[model samples]
Target: MLEKIFKLSENKTDVKTEVLAGITTFMTMAYILAVNPSILSAAGMDSGAVFTATALAAFVGTLLMAVLANYPFALAPGMGLNAYFAYTVVIGMGYSWEYALTAVFAEGIIFILLSVTNVREAIFNAIPKNLKSAVSVGIGLFIAFVGLQNAHIVMGGATLVELFSVDGYNKLNGVNATMNDVGITVLLAIIGILITGWLVVKNVKGNILWGILITWAIGIVCQFVGIYVPNAEVGCFSLLPDFSHGLSIPSIAPIFCKLQFKGIFTLDFVVILCAFLFVDLFDTIGTLVGVSSKAGMLDKEGKLPKIKGALLADALATTAGAVLGTSTTTTFVESASGVSEGGRTGLTAVTTAILFGLALFLSPIFLAIPSFATAPALIIVGLYMMTNITNIDFDDLSEAIPCYVCIIAMPFFYSISEGISMGIITYVVLNLLTGKAKEKKLSLLMYILAILFVLKYAFL
Candidate 1:
C-alpha cells in the first residue's frame, strides 16, 4: 500500500526510512507547537485556543502537502510571520488580532491565485542555478544560527552576539541565572551536537531522531540529579512531561473563523497583506529549492518536478491556517532534517501530519521536548545542507559574488526572503552592468522581481 501510494521503490526509499525521516522532521520542528501559541497570545488571543489552532493548522497543512504534492515537506505557522503578526500588526500598529488575520487570509487567497496562474513556479524556474544553490547554503547558516540561539549557546552580547557564558547571559537579560538553570543546559546542547556529529560520522540510521531523544533523556537525568533545575522565571522548565491535567484537547472556539474585513480596504491593510505575501512566497520557494536540492529531487534544469502541486499545497495551507486562526502557514525549512534522513515520498509527510494530529490531544508530551534537544538536529542538518556549496560556480565572479551576498545575508539579516531579495537584485545588476545579461539569458521575470524587490525596500 505504501509503495503504491508514495512510489517508495522508485524513490529508492522504504517504509522504515520514510517513517524515521518523518519523526526526525517532527521532532526538529515541534517547537512550533509551543512557540506559536506564546507569540499569538501576545496579540490578545487565547493561548489555549491558539495552541489547538496551531496543532490543527499544522496537521491540516502537512496532510495537504502529502495528499496534494506527495512531497516530504511540513507546514506550520511560520516563525517570523508570527512575530510580525503579533508585534508589528496587532501590538505596534494597534490593530485588532481579527483585523490582522483578515490580511493573512487575503494574502493566502492571492497566493492561491498566483499558484494557479503558474506565477510562483515561474519565479522558481527563473532564478539562476547558482543562486538556488546559494539559497540552500544560506538556509544552512540561517538554521544553524537559529539552533545556536535556541539552545542559548549563542546570546546577545556587547558586540551583538557571543558564545554562551553564564555571566554574559545574566548581564544581557538582567536575570539571575546559574549553572543549574542556564549553564548546564547549554553544556548539554554542546555535548548533544558532538554526539550527534559522531553518529553522523559513523553513519548511523535515524541519527538525528536518536540525537533529539538522547539529549532529552540526558536532560531528564540532569534534572533528577539536581544538576539542572527548572526555573520558570528564566524560561527553563521541567524535562518531564506534566500529565497532571490529563489528556484533553483545547477548544479552538475562541479564535476560530474570527476574520475581520471591516478596515481591510485601507493602505495599512494592503501593506500588511503584501508583507505576508512577500515573505511567505519567497520563504516557501527558498525552502522547496534548498531542501529539494539537498535531497537530489531537482531535475537537471534545477527545478523540482511537480512543483505546481507543492506550491498549490503551500498556498492552500496558508489559506486554511488563516481560517483556523493562526499566522501565515508556510513550508518549514526544518523539513531539511527529514530530507537529510532519506525521506523521498509523501509517506514522510503523512507521518509528520499524524504526529501533529496526535499533538492536539497529547500537547503536554510533545511540547515537553525542549529546544535544547532539537537544537542539535537543526545544527547537524545545517551541516548537511551546507555541503551544497560545492555546487556553486565559484570560478564565475558574476555568479559567485551574488551567491556570496545571498549566503551571508540570510544569517546576518536573519531572513530567508531578505537573502533572496538581495541575491536577485545583485545578480541582475551585476550581470547587466558587466555585459553578461544577454549571455546569461536572464529572463524578463527576473528583471521584474529585482525591480519589485527594489521598490519593496524603497517604500515598505
Candidate 2:
C-alpha cells in the first residue's frame, strides 16, 4: 500500500529508508515541542495547552502535506512566526492572545484565497531574488538572537547586546553572575552549542535531537546538585517543570476558536494581518523551492512539480493551526534532513505525522525540556539558514542595500514583518530613484505593496 500510494519504486526509495528519514527529520526539529510553549506562555497563554496545540498541529499539518501534496516535508508552528504572535502581537501591541490568533486565522484564509487564485505565485515571482534570500537570512538572525536571549548567553538591557556581570543581588541591579561572572547556565548553553555544532560538522544524523537530550540531562543533574534553579527571573537555570500532571489531555478550551474578528478590523490589526500574510507566503515558497532543489525535484527551469498542491497544504495548515490555538503552520526547512537521509515521497511525511501524534502522550516528560537546552537547536538551525545568503547577488547596490537592510532589520527591529516591509519599500524606492526600476521592469504589485508598506509605517 505504501508503495502504491507513494510510488516508492519510481522515487527510488524504499519503505525502510523513508521511515528512517522521517524520523530523522522529526528529530532534527522536535525542539518545537519545548520551545513553542516557552515562548507563547509569555503572552499569557497556557503552556500545557500550547504544547498540545503545537504537537497536534504538526501531526495534522504533516499528514495533510503527505496525503495532498505527496511530499516528504513536515509542517509545524513556525518558530519566528510563533515569537511574533506572542511577543509582537500580544505583548508589544497590547492585544489579547485571542486577537493575535484572529490575525493569523484571517491571514490564513487570505493565503488560501491567494493560493487558489494563483495570485500567490505572482507575488512570489514579484519579489526580487536577492530580497527573498535576504528574508531567510534575516529570519535566521532573528531566531538566533532569540535563542541567545532565552539561554541568557547575552545579557539584556538598554544596549542592543551585552554580557552578564556579577554585580548586585536583586533584579534592579543584575542577575548574580557566578564563578567570575560566568555562571552554570552560561556554561551549559556553551556546551550544548559546541556539542550540537560539532555533531553537525561531523555529518551526524539527528544531531539536534541528541544535543537537546544531552543538554537536558546535564541540566537535570545540575538541578540535583543545586546549581540550576527552577524559576529564576533574571539569569538561566530554570530547569524545573511547572506541572507534575501525567497522562492527562491538555485543555485547549481557553484558546480554541477564541479568535476576535471584530478586533482584526482595526488599522493596526490590518497592518499586522498583512505582515503575517506576506511572511507566510514568502516563507512557504522559499522553503518549497529550497527543499525541492535539494531533493532534485526541481526541473531545469527551477520549477517544482505539484507546487500548487504543496502550497495549498501549507495554506490549509495555517488555517487549521489558528483554529487549534497556535501560530502559522508552514513547511520546515529541516525537511532537508529527511531528503539528505534519502526520503523521496509521501511515506516519509506519513511517518513524521505519526511521530507527532505519539508525542502528545509524552507531553508530560517532554515539556520538562527547558529553553536553555533547546536554545542550541535554534542557534544551529539559524546558522544553517545563513547559507542562503550565498544565493544573493551583492554586486548591484540596488539589490544589496535592500538585502542588507532586510537581513539586519529582522533581529534589530524584532519583527520579521518589519524587515520584509522595509526591504520591499527600499527595493522599490531605490530602484525607481536610480532609474533601475524601468530597466528591471518592476512588477505593478511590487510598487503597490511598497506604497502600502510606506503608508502603514507613516500612519498606521
Candidate 3:
C-alpha cells in the first residue's frame, strides 16, 4: 500500500528509511513547538492556545505537502514571519493581534490565487536574487536581535542597546534583579548558545532541539540547587511541567478562527499583507529549489517536477494556519535534514505529519520551555539563515549596495517591511541613476514595487 501511494521502490527508497528521515526532520524543527508560543504570546495571544495551534498547523500543513505535493518537505509556522507578526506588527505598529491575523489570512488567500494561476513563479523570478538573499540575511539579524532581547541579554541603554548587567537592567527598569533571577537566566542563555553552537559544529542531527531541552533541564537543576530562584515579579518561574492533569491537549478556543476584517481595506493593512506575501513566496521557492537540488529531484532545466503542487500546498497551509490562529505556515528549510537522510517520497512527509499530530499531547513539556532556553534556538537558526550572505555578488556595486542597505535596515529600523521597502527603492533608484537599469534589465514588477514603496514613505 505504501509503495503504491508513495512509489517507494520507484524512488529507490523503503519505508524504514523514509520514516527515519521524517523523524530526523521533525527533530530538527520541533523547536517551533516551544518557540512559536513564546513569540505569538507576546502579541497578546494565549500561549497554551498558540502551542496547540502551532502543532496543529504543522500537522495540517505537512500532511498537505504529502498529499498535494507528494514530497518529503514539512511545514510549520515560519520563524521570521512569526517575529514580524508579534513584534513588528502587533507590538511595534500598535495594531491589534486580530488585525495582524486578518492580514495574514488575506495574504494566504492571495498566495493561493497566485499559486494556482502560476503568477507566483513570475513574482518569485521578478525579485533580484541578491535582494532575496539580502532579505534572508536581514531577517537573520533581526530575529537574532529579538532572541538577545528576549533572554534579557540585551537591554535598552544610553547607546540604544547594551550588554546584560544586573545592576544596569535593574536601574533601567526600576526592578530588583539579582544573580538568581534575570541574571542567572541571561547567563544560562549565553551558555545555551555555546552548547547549541557546539552541537551544530559537531554535526548533531537534532542540535537545536537538544539545545532547548538541555538548557531547560539545566535551569530546572539550577532551581533545585537554589542557584536560580523563581521570581514571578521578574518573569522567572519554575522550569517544571505540570503533569498533574495526566497529559491532555490544550484548548485552541482562545485563538481559533479569530480573524478580524474590520480594517482590512486600509493602506497599512495592504502593506502588511504585501510583506507577508513577499516573504512567504520567496522563502518557499528558495527552500524548494535549494532542497530539491540537494536531493537531485530537479529536472534537467533545474526545475523541480511537481513544483506547482508543492507551491499550492504551501499556499493552502498558510491559509489554513491563519484560520488555525497561527502565523503563515510554509515549507521549513530544516526539511533539508530529511532530504539529506534520503527522504524522497511523500511517505517521509506523512511520517513527519504524524509526529506533529502526536506532539499535541506533549503540550506540557513544550509549554514549560522558557524563553531563555528557546532563545538559543532562535539565535542558532539566525546563524543558519545568515549563511546565505555568501551567495550575494558583492563585486557588483549596484547589487551590493542595495543588498547591503536591505541587510542593515532590517535590524536597525527594527522592521522587516521597512528593510524590504528601502531595499527596493534603493535598488531601482540607484540602478536608474547609474545607467545600470537597462543593462541589468530590471523587471517591470521591480519598478512598480519601487514606485509603491516610494509613495508609501512620502505619504504614510
Give lDDT tens digits, candidate 2, residues 1-460.
8889999999999999999999999998787888888888889998889988999899989998998879999999997788778877887778898988889888889888888888999988887888888988998898898888777778655575676444422343544445422356667888999999999899887788788888988987887887766544454435555456767768877778878877555678877887788778778998889899989999889999888888888989899999999999999988999999999999999999999898888877677787778889889878977888999999988999999999999889888778888999999999988999989989998888888888888886
All models: lDDT?
Answer: 0.84, 0.84, 0.94
Candidate 1 lDDT score at position 199: 79
| Best candidate (score: lDDT) | 3
Which consecutive 10 residues in model 2 have the weakest lDDT in total? Answer: 164-173
* Highest-scoring model, TM-score: 3
Candidates sorted by TM-score, descending order?
3, 2, 1
How good is model 2 by TM-score? 0.93
Stretches of candidate 3 off by over 4 Å are none
1-460 in candidate 3: lDDT tens per residue?
9999999999999999999999999999999999999999999999999999999999999999999888999999999999999989999899988889888888888988988999999999989999999999999999999999999999999899999999999989999989999999999999999999999999999899999999999999999999999999888988999898878999999899999988787778877888898988889999999999999999999999999899999999999999989999999999999999999999999999999999999999999999999999999999988999999999998999999999999899889988998999999999999999998989999999888888888888
RMSD, candidate 3, Å: 0.7
User: Higher TM-score: candidate 2 or 3?
Assistant: 3
